[model samples]
Target: MDVSVIGSGYVGTTVAACFADLGHRVVNIDIDEEVVATLEAGEPPIHEAGLPELVATHAGPDSTGRLRATTDYEALLDTDVTFLCLPTPQHADGSIDLSIMEAGAEQLGATLAETGDWHTVVVKSTVVPGSTADVITPAIEEVSGRTAGTDFGIGMNPEFLREGTAVEDFQIPDKVVLGADDERALADMHTVFDPLVDAADAPVVETDTRTAEMIKYANNGFLAAKVSLINDIGNICKEFDIDAYEVADAIGLDDRIGAKFLRSGLGWGGSCFPKDTNAIIHAATEAGYEPAMLKAAVAVNDRQPERFLGLLDEHVGVADRRVAVLGLAFKPGTDDVRNSRAIPVIEGLQARGAEVVAYDPVAVENMRSHFPDIEYASSAAAALEGAHAALAVTGWDEFAALDAAFDTMATPVVIDGRRIIERREGLTYEGLTW
Candidate 1:
């Protein structure tokens, strides 16, 4: 199958490489000349584990020469499957900025209008409900003068790949929900993804466009809710002086509440959860329905970073203290800090006039771009050395080596934001929730 993936960012790049690995001709289209040039030179924009290797393996010339990338919108006209993997960032009002997605759609529609080539348009971006039909489909149909579902087949397939393990997730996903009104398009996509569907035996739910769009929000919101629920439980442990992990351990035995995302931390922060949760709540409210519990979950998760910052304030007296920040990426596996909680934590600590030394094995360069004012250290020990307090903002493995880091710290003040630090002796350990 010939596939054209639009917008070669994280999801787009991963999607292109995965499909190419699965024996399909893939061409990734992007507007940025620099990004396109990098991919053409076998370079990945973001540091996702296994992505660089996979792209290199399946990117250029294969046994059959399947994979290709381009900056041409006209690539969509020749492909059987056009994947819309464009970015839909969050707007200030808690809605998504759909300009890029719209731009891709308009570009494809114009080409289709001129060429009259019928193709399958699959949307793989994480978009809000009603986005495909209300915004994207309308934009395309208005420009093309040909109805969607008739002249050009349309489908919505949301992406659910975690940043670091995106390559693995792409080939082996938990589920694959295909949204399309056209039966032919749906069946054709299933044929291309038949191997993945069979391997996981995951449900291939066939739903309407709106339901498929809602699935992305629902999946991310539920994951965020689990993290917040455990963190909220951590708050309860703080009150009773009990171990939240022990309580979670006992409860997670039940298959009903399986123990994944149950570990407590400084809340979720990446490209997804924060914006998606707020957007879902906002979209629901705008539609005259208030999701009170989810809204509270968002509020609770949002406050988690500050709660850790407050601990820092009390430990070193933020006015004139040297703070060591370990980890900047939202989670451990990827070097992506789009909405990492560490940003706000670092900014908050700086506003309080504390000197910060930050370090992450892979995220240092990315963090340096965002936080040039702070100190970037050579190693975790270097970051921890000579600081009044060290805050574990990210759960990187090097950060988890608390003892060695504590031994080298000038103040021995360790604040475990993710609860990765066990109870250690001979050190000032202030865990946010024990």
Candidate 2:
């Protein structure tokens, strides 16, 4: 199968490589010259586990495969299926910003019309419901002068790849969902994804386009709500003297919940959860319906950063203090800081005029780019050195060893955000919810 993947970010690049690894010819199209150049040089521009190895194994120039990447849209005309991996980021009003996706669709439509190609286009990016037919299909039809299911085919196959574990998720996903209008197009997509299905040992969930689109948003919304629920529980537990970890553990035994995103942390972060949850709520509201519980979930998550700051004030007063923030990324093993709670944590601390020295194993470089005013540290130890207090925002493995590495911090205070650490003896330990 010949596939052209649009957008070369983490999602696009990994999808392109995975398809290439599955013995398909892939042409990855992107607008960034630097990113395209980086991919062509056998180097992954973003940090992800096993990604360099995956790219080297499959999409590497020296590798014996027909995987090539370019910035030209003209190359896409030759591919059998073009995967839209572009981002549909959240707008300022919490609605999804589909301008990028719309522009891409318009360009794709115009190009398809010019080339007169009958290809199957699959939207692999996360999008709000009704977007595929309402926006994308219409644009493509306008460009190609061909109606969907009659002339050109289209489908919505959302991605569920976590940033840190994206390549692994791609290889071992729980399911491959195909949202298509026609059976022929959906079956054709199965051919392109057959390798992933075989590797994942997972079933292909075939459904309508709207169901498939909602699956992505609903999955993210549920995960975000789960995290918020635990954190909300943690907040209430903080008022009364209760161990949130024990409560979370006891609740995990239920087969219905199964304990995955039931983590009590400094709330959910990164690109998908916060935005998707809000978008779903907003979408429902626009349609004259309201999701009150999900709305509360968003509110609770929004309060997390401030709650973390308040916790600092509860144990250790913030006046004339130097606090260490360990772990900048929302999660470990990835450098993405989009919608990270640490932003509010840092802002809250700076508002109090307390000095903040932050460090993340992989995110410090990118963190420095976003926050040039704060002090940057080479390591967690360096961030903790001579600091009045420290907060563990990310649950990196290095943070879990803080009990044994107590000598690293000048002050014996630590705040565990991800609930990874229960009791680091001999230190003034505080859990965000604990």
TM-score of 2: 0.96
Off by over 4 Å in 1: 61-64
Best model per lDDT: 2
**Prediction RMSDs, each to the true structure:** 1.6, 1.6
Q: Model 2, 234: alpha-carbon shift in Å?
A: 2.1
Query: Which pairs in model 2 have colliding backbones?
Result: none
Superposed Cα deviation of residue 262, candidate 2 (Å): 1.8
Candidate 1 lDDT tens digits, 1-434: 88899888889998888888888888889888888877776667778888877777766444334666788888776788899998888889888889989988988888888777678888899888889888999888989899887888889998899988998887778888899878878877887788678766777888987899999999999888888999999978977988888888989999999988888868888888888898888899999999988888888888998888887767678567778888888899888888898899998988899888888888888887788878898888888787888888888875665576677766788888877766678678877777
**How many residue pairs clash per model?**
0, 0
- How accurate locally is residue 64 in candidate 1, as Cα lDDT from 0 to 100? 35
Please write out the lDDT profile of model 2 over residues 314-404, one tens digit for every residue. 7776667778988889888899988877888888888888888898888877787678988988877777777878888888898777554
Any idea what lDDT model 2 has?
Answer: 0.84
Give the whole-model CA lDDT for all candidates, comma-separated: 0.84, 0.84
TM-score per candidate: 0.96, 0.96
In angstroms, how far off is 29's CA in candidate 1?
0.4
